[model samples]
Target: MTQPRIVLYSALLCPFAHRARIALKASGAVYETVEIDLKNKPAWYAPNINPASKVPAISYGAPPDSDVTKPPAGTFLLPESALVVQFIASLYPQIDYKDPIIRAKASFAQLQWDNLVAGRWRKYQFEGSEQDLEPLLEGLKQFSDSVPEEILGDEYGVADIILGPFVTRLFIFANEDIGKWAPGSGPKLVSALSGPEYDKLRKLGAKLDKWPALQETIDNDILVKKFTEILKNH
Candidate 1:
């Protein structure tokens, strides 16, 4: 079967969009990336594509439109980065989604990480206050303790996918700026998430050697790039 032609509408600075890129790359999906200038969105981005005018929208084609749902030719448009990533995973189950039950469980884990942990992490990243990360880290510690190990048993799943980027960033920022402020926070975060199965995941995340796909993005440069674009104008 021919590979699917996927066009991902993305911004380098958006972590949400990065999730889509990671999913596609990790799943081995053949995709073309369209970098959107989020500061000044393109003319085609409105009602024609995504009504929400968000980055990480997607248009997928080819593979002869299997039993699965597919978008109309040139009419394909999907918004929301998380959903787009999940949809791509669903398309290539062998690479990403695996089984229906496993997929569902992974999806739930992704949702929990996104809505709970990620949301809290963002509150710290943007706020310019080290104090805020404390409560969030505590919450994470509690979460790690409570969540069953069986949830992350023996395999990488949506939990790792969803949490990897931010956790990586947290590890980075904490080491750089806040590690001394909260000495145990960074190590605790790492230990909580990095089990034996997630060993590969830990390396994939914050390795001194940059992940090939993200080399152009720099070492934690998204934060700088985004702040430069958004904050400079404002």
Candidate 2:
């Protein structure tokens, strides 16, 4: 099946948008990208593409010469990073979720990491409370343990596509000491991840960094600088 022509509304620094970028890149899809300025979004953005005015939105099936602010009738407008990734993956014939077993495994992988991420991110990454440190490490250990080898098997499928951005960001931010973490908490998190407990996740993160798609989308220096600036509530 032919995938629709996609105009991705994205911001380079956004992890959410990076998910879509990875999916699109890995799928070998031919899509145009419109980098959105998240700070001062264009006037046409919200009404034309995503009502939430967020990055990681897509304008699907619009013609090459189509007006962005007013796409022709039947143009499919989609928002949210995960959904966009899923939609793109669904179109590609190679990344199979058709088999019931694969389907179930994918669902479980996504759910497990999704729940874990939501529970731990704010406390550990952003707020970086001293008390929240151990809990976050425990959660990551659970995540690494649950990651089936088959989930991230030969092909980089939806599971990897969805989780790659966050995991990569987590590793980079932790190691670079970039975030609003309490004094010494960032280094502690970094040190803990360097230990034997996180060997699985650490290896997985390194593997992701090697992927051309992820490598292209993620610039380690840029991420460190960009996130550090953003985290400065100073």
Candidate 3:
């Protein structure tokens, strides 16, 4: 079977873009990547590729071009990380959900995490106070407990791909660097999240350690360094 031609527009440091990239890789589909500079987006990118001018946009089943409004016949343009990941998963049989019910459940779970848990983490990371740490810790514990033992039994699927990137960032960067970046509140926040009270969350962290695809996605040294630099400046 001929593989669909895919071009991924992405920035390495964006976790959302990273999620789409992971899905693409795990699908075992051959696709080209065009890294976009988020700081200085090209003039043609917004008009031609994605109106939102975001990384992790994809042009499917066709070569990349300057048509902004729509893709060529036999192809389509998809933006947004979660939607792009779902589209690729559906297109390729290799990484698709084994059961429709499970797919629905996982999709719903992913949405909840994205909207609620991830939002809380972001709030704690950027504008959290000492009083805010307890809620964030509680949220992390709830999130970890809510996740299925493997999410899809023995197979890696969409839900894992969707949440894996942000989970990695939270444990690695947020836990470690929050103190240095945010001062007094930082260390306390990290301790509360990673401390004994949240061992379930730590166990979830261990699961991510064993996920090879996630490791590959989050282990980029250059990406990590760049993200750390950004956080330090934040």
- TM-score leader: 2
The runs of at least 3 residues in candidate 3 whose Cα sits more than 4 Å from the true structure, single-residue gaps closed, are 63-74, 150-154, 178-191, 194-200
Instruction: Give the TM-scores of the predictions, in the order they appear.
Output: 0.68, 0.89, 0.83
**Top-lDDT candidate index:** 2
Scored by lDDT, model 1 comes in at: 0.60
Ranking by TM-score: 2, 3, 1
Scored against the true structure, residue 49 in model 2 reaches a CA lDDT of 82
Q: Tens-digit lDDT track for model 1 on 35-125?
A: 8888898776765568788877887673444312234555557898768867876886644645667666556655556566676766654
Among residues 3 or more apart in sequence or in different chains, the pairs in candidate 3 whose N, CA or C atoms overlap within 3 Å are none
| Model 2 poorest ten-residue lDDT run | 148-157
lDDT of each: 0.60, 0.78, 0.72
Q: On residues 1-234, what C-alpha lDDT tens digit does candidate 2 reach at each position?
A: 565678888999898999998888888889888988898999989887888999899888998788766778789999999888878877775654557777676667667677776568666777777777777878787777766666554466676777788888887777677767766666677687787777767767877877888889777887787777888853
Alpha-carbon runs more than 4 Å astray in model 2: 1-3, 96-99, 152-154, 182-184, 195-197
Q: Which residue runs does candidate 1 get wrong by more than 4 Å?
A: 62-74, 97-105, 128-131, 146-155, 178-234
